[model samples]
Target: MTCPLIQKDLANACALETVKKIVAEIGDGIFCVLVDESGDCSNKEHMVVVVRFIDGRGFVVERFIRIVHVPNISATGLKKALETLLSGLGLCISKIRGQGYDGASNMRGHLGCLKTLIKKREPQAYYVHCFAHQPLLALVSIARNHEDVDWFFCEINRLVTFIRSFNKRQDLLCKKQVSHFADLIENELMETGTWLNQELSIARANDTLWGSYFRILTRLVWLFTPIVELLEDLNSD
Candidate 1:
């Protein structure tokens, strides 16, 4: 029997086919790349590549090209990886208008960084400090310099850690959210359903970095009542 997991060759073929359609639609148009690298739980390094461009209809679009696994994380290695990726996507490096990476010293190095290397290859490609990371850097500076704000965040983070610590609590929380929604539906107090037959409108804006796990706890606190009620219902069930 065939295994349930996707075979590498087939998956790569399918991914290439999708990227082929995206490039065909983009068609020699100028575009910018947003690149970021992260380490996975398995200790493997992966790079996420996203492209932003204007389509034929004058509408802006952003699409993920792929997450590539690189054997090495050096500047030279990453630059080579990018070259191979663009070639595989059937896109010319000269058509690249911009590049973005995090505020890391290695990435933004004046001499041999990926930004400098790409610029050498295509002079028109401007290197941008990832706009989303700007606010994050600001916040980091604030947290370090400020005492009260840091303490407040630390307390909230502890609370969030407690909430997410156990699977039993998580399941109970989901149950409560469901029960609360049902209660609202039963009382005819809220419309719980809607249908969209046409295209969905998406906001075109520079998405900034939003703070991390703290938002999860903030949301949980806001929805605490319904969550409590749902958990009670689950217990009685």
Candidate 2:
């Protein structure tokens, strides 16, 4: 099928008109804005901003209204890009009811420059830190403070890497039901901390163990003889 003749400028103008018409028809509704920045293979940073709002029927819809190629991740650059995008959409920063972003240092801050500017403009705008990011930050904190825990994670990762790298080792581990056993072990391990006399320390130790349990189980099952010998040698020591 032959493609129809299309003019780029006319296409963009019509698209913008459609968006304006839709927003006008929707009337007043809470708008959720999401902003994020990413770097491409060429190492050029681009900022994308999206707006979501509810319609008359109370159904929520999201629209990608602006994508600006920012020079950098500086506060001034982000502010300029966001301001320009909002102005072009005939949106006041104050109209935004909710905001979401990947918890970048620039995006999720209260004292940092970006959030300060945003709060100054919209005092009631709700700010949410991405949930997935919060857990990752918590994990990183735990990993940083405990040397033995960090070592266990590094070793577990190395074991997983080794198994995944070799087709035979992965197949053997799967045949031994290591994955399923690891899942069961983790469930049991969670219960272990609840009845401990030294609850807090035991829980922390169990948390580290649970985190790396699967890798250790897979390694043990796949390399059973070596693991048994290592355990025996440790006992003799």
| TM-scores of all predicted structures | 0.59, 0.52
Name model 2 segments beyond 4 Å from true: 1-18, 25-28, 131-237
lDDT per residue for candidate 1 within 52-73, as digits (tens), equals: 8999999999889999998888
How would you encode candidate 2's per-residue C-alpha lDDT over 90-119 as one tens digit per residue?
Answer: 777768777777656677664665666676
- The TM-score measured for candidate 1 stands at 0.59
Model 1 residue 22 distance off true place after TM-score fit, in angstroms: 0.8
Would you list the C-alpha lDDT of every candidate in the order shown?
A: 0.74, 0.64
Model 1, backbone clash pairs (residues 3+ apart or across chains), number: 1
